[model samples]
Target: MTKATSAARDDRPPLLALVGPTAVGKTAVSLRIAEALDAEIISGDSMQVYRRMDIGTAKLPLAEREGIPHHLIDILEPEEPFSVSMFQSLCAEKIREIHERGKLPFLVGGTGLYVESVCYGFEFQGDSGDEAFRERMRHFAQAHGAEALHARLAAVDPSTAARLHPNDERRIIRALEVFETTGRPLSETQAQTRAAPKTSPYRLCLIGLTMDRAALYRRINERVDAMIAQGLVEEVEALIRSGVPQDAVSMQGLGYKEIAAYLRGECSLAEAVERLKRDTRHFAKRQLSWFRHMQDLVWAEADEEGKIDDLFKSICAIIAGKFHLDLEYIR
Candidate 1:
């Protein structure tokens, strides 16, 4: 391995994770935080990694990035499979480079698993699936239903089964498939490869952004309307016309999925809009729950007018206190 890759795998410097639910103004607050800290932004979002997935993923434009250097966004095609392991590996390299440059690494966005994978140094076994193995699993899922496949998984890999949602039959079946192919439980392999906690080379300061649910929901609703006005429907239409798969991860994003359903005549446009609003609210709730479960997170609430500066100051104070870093130098 190259020096850069080796350093990335081992070093954990003073890192700041800015995380929250969708449409919670994380982008705006993150920009301010990056500016204040003289840091580079490493995107924690999974969806934002794909190119040409801008409108539906709500990706930040180059202009909106405000000259703040960002890593790991728009680096993949919508059809490619980008896993959390890939994210962890790439982000670790980015963090190392940022630290080497004498700047802080600010991890920003709402993808919980991506953040947690790095924070906890979670290990993912290599998924080198043969077509035959995958076909067998797919056939099983089809023949017996996802539940039956999940039952088989539970019988073989209870640890993975416990953590996965029953409805997440896709993952359940995949985990089982991995076990069958490798003759080892996926959970056990991950547990064995797990790195020591805080052995992370960076000193991480996690900052979580939040707002009143009602207010956040209102923001989400308004943002959806704004996206529609900004031609989100047309954007989705373009992606479909370009032959992007409806089941692709990029297409499964909050706004993309709902709008794709409308395009496919599965729902009316108005109904899709309502579903987008409702699903985004639920997503925010889940984001909050995930952040609450993480350790060492500093919380900041959006101001009444949603001025990002207020939340930015709040986050800076928390980081300074936690890391003993000088705000003056950062500013």
Candidate 2:
């Protein structure tokens, strides 16, 4: 084949995305699928990119990965910032590399924004930062609170506000800045970006995993307890001692923030753990809501009895049927 033909073929690899709420056994199922397909795993998680955040982020250790080649984890420090644009660029490179190596690339995580950006080919419009405007917003948030700041965004762009959490001050500020600079709601700009007729370069298969709500909540709570038992507190304390600021984005992640609060004597350890569980349950609800809005997702329901093998089989069937691959290879 000529160079142009090879380039076209490179843009059309089979891309598999496994996404769902946290603590829903995505890791184990993803591993099984990757092994069966001889594929590599690219983490779609925002938190797992940061080093020294293992316990709270539930990062799968090298042993648990079972010799699978996993990319995009531990690629940054706790203080470094990561964005959807960065993830899109890096993940695309990794996908091409995996395809070049004659292996499929499976994106596995619960971060809806990152996954959807890659799926739809989001063209991120760079925001020209106005340091003065940013400082003003920062002062307003500081004087009032993150809730007040998020409310400001809701007034301008309710859709973005609904998608983002109040504690996500960084994004809230950025959204506000986008509006101020462009005279358009960030949502409107994003809609226009997506409206551009850009065909995705990959043959995509999206797999979503879910379970009974009560069962999922129970699993999330149990997972939180397990993290605590595994010294989540100590992990957060080490980050803080190493000068990871409390207000940093990494510290604002699910488990890290709660544990940091406890370490600062702002809340008791028991209270912090309970708060972590509750917040994680709420986050899972939001995740489900986001996935429900995505079209063309093949959802596999995990049984209440924790039958992951059954779930894996259903996913494999979908992959084989859609991609015309043989199941015997995986078997």
Candidate 3:
């Protein structure tokens, strides 16, 4: 493992990222990690950015943040659109300010694309050429199995293609589409982003939290049940009553979409709940897949009550030993 040698450099600010799936206990653990490192948190979640979209997103209650200074939460209304480029620019500013205020920046959330943008300094340049090409590639993959199309990508852009599973036909085709339209390999684009010297001011380490798949699935089921008890159906009903379109991103989230189906007479409430559970499990699986591909990361579990604190302590020890920062200040 090629660890970074510098503690604080001019290019990138030191950042510690806590990323995992929904219902995986990210909020509590992130708060502990923040306290341990004297860090302020920047939420990387796309959904949590909206104000009224609270319950569906499992957003941290105001009491939970406990004056720890979390950024980028509740910054938009559900009606507005937020993009990766907007997130990147906003986070960069917040990181710089937090560092100047003598606090570390902790990025915490389950949004993989948003986290990757901050970590890799990805340019969210609009690729206007991808849509049509992507549709054509998708049709081709559908006609001739996803494996064969992905295999074709592996021959041309092995690195980028390697990140995709054979079954992830969408991303595989998108990568191929990017290559076809741009005339530059997706691997080359990714490498350029990775190689581009970071402009953030913090050093960073990534931590991943996971548990047994069955256990995780159990927790997910419980969470869905709890969301239902918390009036998730009523929430969706209100959104529908208010004339919010089903196609809106806010409505497309796991709980909202399923309940919307129930409201439309497509399924029983019980069936909707089951579908929600299954969809959430699949979403968590995708999240874990993305996190597992990260180059160097620490993984922990959320079993006991203080387990998150213990994990935070472990991370603080590593950061202190490596960067000469005092954990006391953070505590």
Candidate 4:
């Protein structure tokens, strides 16, 4: 290989990310990490992209970011569609830009797919934007033969082709559809996904924060209560009045879903709050599960006997140790 080719294959940019279950103090802890590393923040969150979701998503107000440059929050309308592929592309660019500026890209949020996709370079064959391609494939199969479609699939994704019988016209077309949409063979995408946790394109430090189960649940409940007090119901009400559908993907988020339920008279306010609390606790569990499956996550206790300073110090130490930096880089 040439020198440039060799370096391109061997060298990967450094990426630092903090992730955790909701209400686990990631925000406060991330601010410290950003300041310590002179990093810019890219939110690895799915819901925070929608505008007017402030209360439900718990977006940190700009004044409270401590002058940290944060990206990928509030960049979408509630009606627009977003997917993991979009976040992966946008976050990759942000990471590169941060590197060019001689600073770190600190990805901080709770969205598991969004965060891990960037860490491992998951090539997402996003939402089916290939109905036309599928139609054409089906037409070609009908006009020629299932055997011909199978041959074409073999030429592209032989692994997928080998497993599929020529008579399986639907599946053959689907695989070809995937190849057409993602510009990569379907087999390669599946293989990459299977190996994602084991492979990465970045020198990574991923920090996860957790606390005692009962304590985390308690915090979640309190956060739900606080959101109600902070007018979460009103926020949902405004979104609905502004023509955001109750079943929109953004509206389906934890707080918005439950409160929108209450607004539609499907439940009372008290019942909605209870459901939100329960669903949020469940969401936190799923988040933990997702992170636990990923390799090389350095875990820290965000509780530490309810001592924020202690938890922050421990997390800082984990990152510093992971990347071989002085732990006291915190300002």
Q: Tell me the spans in candidate 1 whose CA falls farther than 4 Å from its real position.
A: 1-12, 129-133, 140-172, 175-199
Candidate 4 regions with alpha-carbon error over 4 angstroms: 1-10, 129-197, 304-306, 328-331
> Against the true structure, what is each candidate's TM-score?
0.82, 0.91, 0.76, 0.77
Per-model tally of clashing residue pairs: 6, 0, 12, 0
Q: Residue 195 deviation, candidate 1, in Å? A: 14
lDDT of each: 0.79, 0.87, 0.77, 0.83
lDDT of 2 at 3: 12
Off by over 4 Å in 3: 1-11, 127-201, 304-306, 326-330
- Per-residue lDDT tens digits for candidate 3, residues 201-246, read 3466777777778878988899889989988888889878888776
Which regions of candidate 2 fall more than 4 Å away from where they truly are?
A: 1-11, 187-198
Which of the predicted structures, 1 or 2, would earn the higher TM-score when compared with the native? 2
Q: What lDDT score is found at residue 99 in candidate 1?
A: 88
Predicted structure 1, TM vs. truth: 0.82
Model 2, total clashes: 0
TM-score of 4: 0.77
- Clash count (model 1, backbone only): 6
Model 4: lowest-lDDT 10 consecutive positions: 1-10
Tens digits of per-residue lDDT for model 2, 1-331: 0011112333467889999999888998899888888889999999999999999999999988999999999999999888888999999999999999988899999998899888777778664588798999999999999999999999999988987778788889999998998889998986666546555667888999999899999999999999999999999999999998888988999999888889989899999999999999999998998788665678999776666788988998888766766666565
lDDT of 3 at 84: 78
Residue 14, model 4, lDDT: 83
What value does the lDDT take at residue 278 in candidate 4? 82
Tens digits of lDDT, candidate 1, 94-186: 988998998878888898878978876776767666668777877887887768877888999998886654445456767877787789998
